[model samples]
Target chain A: MVYDVSKLTDFHYSALKEISNIGIGNAATSLATMLGSEVKVMTPDLKVARIEEVAEFSGGADKLVSGVLMKLSGCVKGYMVMLLPPESAKLICNTITKEQDSDIKNPMNESLISEVGHILGSTYMTAFSDFLKIDVFASAPFHTYDMIGAIMDNILIQMSQEVEHAIILDTLFTLKGNDMHGKLLTLFDPISLELILEQVNALFR
Target chain B: MIVIGMADYAVTRSPEKLTTLGLGSCVGIALYDPVTKIGGLIHIMLPTIENARFTDNCAKFADSGIPYLIEQMIGIGAVRRRLVAKIAGGAKMFSFNSDASMNIGERNIQATKVVLSEMKVPIISEDVGKNYGRTVVLDTDTGVYYVKSAIKGENVI
Candidate 1:
C-alpha cells in the first residue's frame, strides 16, 4: 500500500497528537524530578512535509544547533532527533550540573548533554511503548553540533530513499522561570507510519 | 552564493560560490572547470535510480545526477576536457547498525566514482568515508573545495 499523508483523517491526526502529548508529559515529569526544577514540554506540532521543506522548517539550514539523534526499532522504526540551539544546550547542561558546580565550557559537558539526551529518548520511547502496547526501543543517542541543515540532511536522506515525504512531529521543551528551550523532532518511516495509522484506526473501531 | 538543498543540483559561473551542508550518508559532488571558472554541485541522496519509483529529479541519485550535472556545466560553457571533480560528504553517522543499508555512505561514494569515471571526469580530490558530518563549499573562481567538519575542523582541497 502506498503511504499518502493527504489521506490521513482528523482522527488520525488527533490520535497521534494525543500519543505525543502523553509521551512528552511523561518525559517532562522525569526531567523535572532529575533536575529539581519544573520542566514544561509543549504539545507537538505535527505536519507532513517534503524533504526540501524540512531544512527551512525550524529555522534555516545554516542555523547552528546541536542534535542528539536516536534510531528506533521493533514495532515501528524511525529516527528521533532532539535539537537545541547552542544557548539552549548550555542552559540544559548548566541546569543538569548546577549542584556539582560544573561549567558548560568543560569538555565533560558534551557527555553530560549526551546523558540528558539518553534520558529524554528513553523516557519518550517508554511512554510510547506503554501507550501503544507495542515493543519499541531506541539506540544509544549520537550527538552532533553543526548547521541545522546538515543535521537534517543526514536524516532526510535516509528517509527520502524510502519515501519523498516525512511526518514531522515538532515539540518544544522549556524550563519554568527560565529562558531555556529545546526542540524535539520525531520522524516516522513510511512503513511504520502506515502501521501506526492502522493501529490508530483499530482503536476507533 | 548558491545553496543546493538536499537532492538538488545547480550550475554557476565565477564569483558565485556553491554550498551544501550536513552530509551524513548523502554525497555532495562538485564539478569545476578551471578554464571557464564554471562550477556545479549536486547533493544526491541515494546511489542509483534503479529502485527509484520516480526519477523526475535528476539530482537525487548518483548515476543520473552526476551525468546531469556534467551536462548542465557543459551547457553553461564549461569544456568537458577541463572539468575536474571534487567530492565530499558520504559519512556513516550511525554505528550501531551494521546493515547493508547503513553502509550507504560507502556505496554512494563508490557509485559516484563509477559515474564520474564513465563520464570521463577526473576526480581530483575527495574528503569522504568517516563517522562525522561535513559541509562542503565550492569556490567557482579558484575551483577550490572547502570542507568543514565538527571534529576535524576545516580543510581546503
Candidate 2:
C-alpha cells in the first residue's frame, strides 16, 4: 500500500499518541534513575490547541520558574514544552543540588535551569523516540523564566507551521519521590501528528 | 548611593552602596563623579527600544535610565563632563535558544552603549557577554565602582 500524504494529519496524531505513551513511561524510568527511587509519571489528559493557548495556560500559575521548549522532528515536526512551577523547579534542583545544600530555604541557583533542561528534555524526547521506534535529533535545549507576554510570543512565533492546526499534549507529571510535581506539554502540527492518531486508532481495533 | 537588582534599579545620595547584583540578561547602568561621589545605578531588563520602560513608577528603561542616573548625579553636585558611565552584567545566561527572540544579555549591552553614546557620556568600562551573572558595586565612599562575575572573580568596571 502506498503511503498517502493526504492522511499525514491522521498518521501524525497516531504517532504522537504512541510517542506520548512511551515517552511518559521512559521519562518515569529516567526520573527514577535520577532520584535513586521509583517515581511514577502519569499519562496526562490531552488537549489540542494553538501556541497562543499555552500563554493563557501558563498565566494561571502562581509562580513559574522555567519554560522548556523543544521541537520533535524526523517523521513529524511538532513542538513540546515543559512548564515547571517554581516548586517543581526547586524539586528538580534538589535532585542534583540537594546533598550540597544544608537548607532548602535558599533560593534555587541559576545552574539548575540548565540541569532540569537536560533531564526533562531527555525524558521527553526518549518517549517520543520510543513510540516512533526511531531516534529524533533535537537541538540544544532552549530555556526561559518569568517571561512577559512579548517574550513568549517572540520565542514561539518562530515556529512557522506548514499546516493550519496544532495539537496539545498536556501531561501532568507527578514526580512522586520527593513531593514535587511538574507538567510536560507536547504540541504537534499536521505534518506528524495525524499519523500517530491513525495508527493508535487502528491498533485499538 | 544607588542599588540595582537583576532587571531593576535604584538611585539616592543616602550613602548606601548603589549596587546591581546577579545581572545576566540586564545591564547595571552606573554613573558617578569623583568631585561629589554622587552616584546611581539602573537594573535594566531587556536592551529594547520598544516598551523599554516597564515601570511607570520610575525611569525603568535603559534610554530613560542613563539620563536619570546622570541627572541624579548632577543634582548632587556632579558635572556632566566629569561623569562617566560604567556598565556591568549582560551575560548570556543560556546558549541553547540562539534563535529565540532578543539575545537579551547582548541587547542590554548594546543598548546601554547606544544610550550613553548619544548623551556624550563615555563608557569607562564594561564586563559583559558571557555565560555568567555579574555583581556590580559602586562605592559612595571613594567614588569608585567594580564589577564581578562569581566565576570570573573581580574586575574593575
Candidate 3:
C-alpha cells in the first residue's frame, strides 16, 4: 500500500511532537551551556507538507541564511537541519570566537557553524532515540550559507524521488533574550515515520 | 511577475517577467522567442524523468521539462525556430558528500544541455555550475535573463 503521511492519527502527531520537544529541549540546553546564557525554546511545531513547499515552510524561499544539514541512518532515515539568519550566525560566531566581528564565510567560522549544528543534531537525536527506544545515528554535518530554497532544494530533490510529502518538526530557540535565534528542523521519511510510530505505539501497548 | 516554484514552469508574453527563487542544485531554463517577445521558464530538480517513480510532474526533470516548456511557448504564439535558451542555477551548494549521485548539480546542468540540443534550441548564454545558489529572472520584454546570488552579486546573461 502507498504510504501517506496525512493518514497519521492525532495521537501519533502528539507523540511525535512531544518527542521533538524533549529532543530540542536537550539541544537548547547544550547551546545555552556553550553560550553561557539562558536559551528560550518554543514548543516544536509538526506538519506534513509537500517536498516542494518545505523551503517556504522553514522560512522564506529567497531568504538568506546559514544552513547545516546532517543525514540520519540506522533504524530511521532522513535529515536534520539547523537554519540561522545572518545576524544570528554572526552573533554565534562572534560569541564563540570571542571577536567583536567575525566573518561567517571564513572557513574557520564555517566549520564552527557546522560543529554547532552537529552538537544540536546529535544532542536532539540522542534524546529522541532514548525516549523512543530506537537506534538512530546522525552523520557529520554539512554547512552552507545561501538562500533557504537553495540550501534545501538538494535534499528536497532527493526526498521527492521517494515520497511527495514529508513530516517536518520545527523548533525555534533564542539566546539571551537577544535577536540571536535559529530553527532546528527535522525531516523524517514515511518509512522511518512508521518505525518511529511503531515505537510510539509500543508505549500504549 | 510570474513566480515559478520548484518543479514548475510558466509561459508568458512581452512586458511580463518570470522568476524562480533560491536554486541550488536545481537548474532554471529560460526559453525566449525574440520575435514574439514570448518566453517560458522552468525550474527542474532532476536530470531526467526516466525511471522516476513520480512522473506526474514533468516540470521536475530536464528531459521532460524543456520539451514541455517548448510546447507551452508554442501554444502561446512562440516560434520554435526562433526560441533561444538562457540557463542558470545548477550549484553544488556543499561538498560534504562525495557520492557520484550527490553531484546532481553537474548532472542537472549536463542533462539540460543535452535536452536543449536535442530539441534544437541554441543556448545563448548560461550562468551555472558553482558552489553558490542563484535566483534567476527571465525578462520577456528584451529576452534577457538575470541571475542573482547572495554572495556573488548579480549578473545578466
Candidate 4:
C-alpha cells in the first residue's frame, strides 16, 4: 500500500506519540538505574520531515554529539539513534567511570556509554513490541562521537533513496536536579512507517 | 567560508573557502580552476536522479549535481577546460548483511567519476571509500582539498 501523508489523522499522531512515550519512559528508567540517579524523560516531539531538514532537527549540522545507533528489524525495519550532547555525555561517563570528568573517547568511558546505549535500545524495542503486539528486534548497538550532521547523513542517505520524508521521534532526557541533558531520535523507514499506520488504522476501524 | 548542506552546491571565487560536513555514503565534489581561482563544491547524496520524487533540487543527486556545479563555476569566470576536480567522503558507516543497496558509498563514487568524466573534468586527487565519516573543505585560494576523519585524522588531497 502506498503511504499517503494526507491520510494521517490526529488519532494516528496521538497513537504514535503514546507508543513513543512508553518507549522513552522505559529507556529513561534503564538509564537512571545505571547512573544511580533520578532521570526525567520528556514527551517526544514527533513529526514527518524532509531528508534535508533532519540535520537541523537535533540542533545544527556542526554540533558535536555522541550517538549510539542501532538497526531494528522483525516487525519494523528502521534505525534508532540515542544522542547525547557533550555535556550530557561527560556527565554520564564520569558517573559510570567514577572520574571527575571522563573524556568520552576514553576506552573505558566509551564502553560504558555503549552499554548504556544497548540498554536503552533494548528497552525501547521491548516497549514497542509490547504496545504493537508484534515481534521487534534490534541489532547490536554501535557507538560514534562525531558531528550530528555526519551521523544522520549516513542514515538518511540510504533512507532518501526510497522515500523523500521520514518519521522523526525526538525525546529529551535530563538528570533530576542537574543540568545534564540528552536526546533520543528514532527514525522509521517508509515500509515500516506504512506498516505502523496500517495497524493503527485497523484498530480504529 | 561557505557551508554547503546535503544535496546542495555552492560556487565561490579566490580568497573564499567552500566546505561541507558529515559525508556518510555521500560524495563531496570539489571543482577548481587554477587560472581563475574559481571553485565549486557539491554534497551529492544519491547516484542518479532517475525516477526521483523530487527533481527541483538537482544538487541532491550525482547525475544532475555534478554538471550543475560545473556550469555554475563556468558562469563565474571558471574555464571548463582549465577545471580540475577533487573528491572525498563516500563512506560505508555501517556494514549490513551483504545487501547491495548498503554499498551506496561505492556506487556514489562510481557515479561521481562517471559524471566528472562526461563533463571532461580531470580528477586531480581523491580520498574516498572507507568505513568512517568525513568532513571536507576546499580552499579556493590555493585549490587544496582537506579531508578530516576520525579514523585517518586529516589529509590533504
Candidate 5:
C-alpha cells in the first residue's frame, strides 16, 4: 500500500501531530538559545491538503515573507521551510547584529536569515529522526524574500507531480516580549509518511 | 473578481476580473477576446505534462493549460482567432547552482511562449523572468494585465 493521505486514520494523524510537537519543541529551544530570549511554540497543526491550497495554510499567498528551503535526503524525503515575515526577519537580524535597523534584503542579513533557517530545519529534523528512529539529513539552505505563494511554488510543483495531497506539519514560534514570529513547515513525501507510520505502529504494538 | 489558484484556471466575461496570486516559478497566462469581452487565465506550475508522474490536472502544465484555457474561452463564446495573450510570473525566486532542472522558472517561461505561439495566440505583452514574485490580475473589459510585486512595485502590461 502506498499509504496516501486518504489512508491515514485518526491514530496516524495523532501520531504525526505528536511527532511534530516534539520536533517543534526542540526547534524552539534552538531558537531561544540563538536569540537569548524565551521562545514559545504552538502545538503544531497538521493538515492534509492539495498542493495548491498550501500557500493559504502558511498564511496568505500575497503575504510578503522571507522563505528558506532545504531538501531532505536519506531515509526521509521531502522539504523543510522556514517562513518569516519581513518584520520577524528584520527583528532577528537586528537582535543578532545589535543594530536598531537591519534590512533583511541586505546580503549580510540575508545570509544571517538563511543560517537561522538552517539551524531551525536541522534541529527540527534531528528531533524527528531521533523520535522515529530514522536517518535523514537536510541540505544547505536556499533563501528568498518574496510572497509566500511564490516562495513555495517550486516545492509545490515538485510535490504535485508525485501526489495529489501533501501532509503539512506547520509550527508557529513566537519570541517572548517581541511581536515577531515565524513558522516552520515540514512536508514529507507520501512514501516517507508510510515509513514513519510504520515506526509509529511498531512502538504501540 | 475571481481568483485562480495555482494549477487552476478560470474564464469570465466583461465587467469581471480574474487574478492569480504569488506566482514564483509558476506562469500565469491570460487570454482575451476583445470583441466578445471574454477572458481566461491559467496558473501553470510546470512546462509540460509529458514527463510528469501525475498528469491528471491539465491546468498544472503550460503546454496543456494554454490550450485548455483557450478551449474554455471558446466554449464560453470567445473567438479563437481574436484572442490575444498577456503573460506574467515565472521568476527564479532563489538561486541555487545545481542543474538545469532546478531552473524551472526559465523552462516554464519558454514553454509558455512556445505553446502560445503554437496556438497562434499573439502575445501582446509579458512581465516575466526575474528573482521576484508576481501577482497578476486580468481585466476582461479592457483585456489589460496588471502585474503586482512586493519589492519592484506594480506594472500594467
Candidate 6:
C-alpha cells in the first residue's frame, strides 16, 4: 500500500526550518543581552507531526511545567510549547534568584519553560514581523503543569477534529557562562503554515 | 491583575480585585462572604497532594489555598457560614492522553471540590470543564467573578 504525504511540500518544510533557525537566533541574541551573560544558542531539531500525534509523542511524561505562546500571524495561530527540563529549570531560577533557589518549588520564581517562552516568542514574533513587515504580539505567558497534554485533551474533546500538523521549531540556549540550557520552541499550526507558505512564495517570486 | 504564583497566596479587601489570564487547566478559585465583602483569589497550578513537586503550603495546594482564602475572608469578618465560593478554569486541556500527566485539570477540579465540601463551603457558582483556556477575574469590590474563554464567549464561571 502507498501512503500520501501531501499535507505539506518539501520546499515548504525547508522554508519553515530555515525560518525557525533565523527566528530562534534572533531570540537567543535578545535573551543573552537581557541576562548580561554569555549565551550560546544551538540549532534546533525539527519535527513535523499532526497536533493529534503530540499525545503519542509525549508518551506519559509527568506533570512538568511548559511555557506556551499563542500567536497569530495573518491567519495562523497555535501555541508554542517549551518544556523546561528540571535541571534547566533550576539553572534559570538560579540566574534570577538573588541566592540559590530552594529545593522546594517556588511560585515566586518564574518557570524556565515560560522564561524561554517569553524569550523565544518575542524573538520569533520580531523575526516574523520583520519578514511580513507587520506587528504581532503574544499574551502574557502563564506557567502550568501538563499544559501540552491538557491542550491536546481540549482539542480532542472540543474540536473533535485533527488540528493538522505542527512544524516543531526547537532550539537550545546555553546561557550564564554556559551553565544554563533551555529549549526555545515555535509550533505553527496549519493556518499559520499557509500564511507562511504564501509569504515564502511571495519572497521567491 | 494579581498573579498568584504556585505555592503562593494573595488576599484582597473591599475595593481591591485580583485577576489572572490564560489559565490552561489550572484552577482559579475565589472565596468571599457577601456580608463582609472580604474576598481573595488563589490560582493554583499542581494538585500537590503528596508534595512530590514540593508545594506543601495550604496557600499553594488547592486543599490549602481554598482554606487559606476562606480563612482570610473570615478573618476580615466574612462569616464562614455565609461565604460564597466561585471557581473557574480546570479545563480538561490536552485530552489526547488519559494519563497522570494529562489529568491535572480534572484532578485540580476534583480536589478543589473535595476540600470545599469537607470544609462545608458551598460552591455558589462554577465555570469549569471544557477544552478551551480561561481568564478568571475576582472583583473584591463586589465579590463577583467573570471568566472569559480563550476560544469562545465570556461568562460567569
In the range A1-205, model 3's lDDT, one tens digit per residue, is 5457878998988899999999999999998888788888999999899888898898988999999999898998889999999899999999888999989999999999999999999999999999999999999999999999999998898899888888899999999686799999999888888888889999865
DockQ scores of all models, one per candidate: 0.46, 0.05, 0.87, 0.53, 0.84, 0.06
Candidates' TM-scores? Answer: 0.90, 0.51, 0.98, 0.89, 0.97, 0.51
* TM-score of chain A for the candidates in order shown: 0.92, 0.72, 0.97, 0.94, 0.97, 0.77
Candidate 4 on A36-126: residue-level lDDT in tens?
9999988888888888878877677667778888888897877888888878889998877788978898877777777888898889889
Of candidates 6 and 3, the better by lDDT: 3
Per-residue C-alpha lDDT of model 1 across residues B28-142, encoded as one tens digit per residue: 9999999889999999888999978767788889999899998999998999988899999888766654886668888899999999999899999999988777888999999
Candidate 3, B78-155: lDDT as tens digits: 999999999998899878657867799999999999999999999999999989899999999999899999988999
RMSD of each: 2.5, 10.6, 1.1, 2.6, 1.3, 16.3
Q: lDDT per residue, candidate 2, B1-157, as tens digits?
A: 3444333455555367877545556677877776666777787654443542224423435776677767777776778998787787666655655664546667667888998999998887777776655667887666567876545678875
* lDDT tens digits by residue: candidate 6, A5-122: 2566777667767777788778777766766666787766667764434433533222333435444434455555555555666666666564575331456654544565677677
Error of 5 at A68 (Å): 1.1
lDDT of each: 0.82, 0.59, 0.92, 0.85, 0.91, 0.62
Off by over 4 Å in 2: A1-29, A38-116, A121-205, B1-3, B51-59, B97-102
* lDDT comparing candidate 2 with the true structure: 0.59
Error of 6 at B85 (Å): 30
Docking category for candidate 3?
Answer: high
Show model 6 residue runs off by greater than 4 Å.
A1-7, A56-60, A66-74, A102-104, A111-116, A146-162, A176-179, B1-157
- Give the clashing pairs for model 4: none
Judge candidate 1 at residue A60 and give its lDDT: 74
- Score candidate 5 by lDDT: 0.91
Which candidate has the highest DockQ of all? 3
Candidate 3 regions exceeding 4 Å error are none
Q: How many collisions between residues are there in candidate 1?
A: 1
| Candidate achieving higher DockQ, 1 or 2 | 1
Against the true structure, what is model 5's DockQ? 0.84
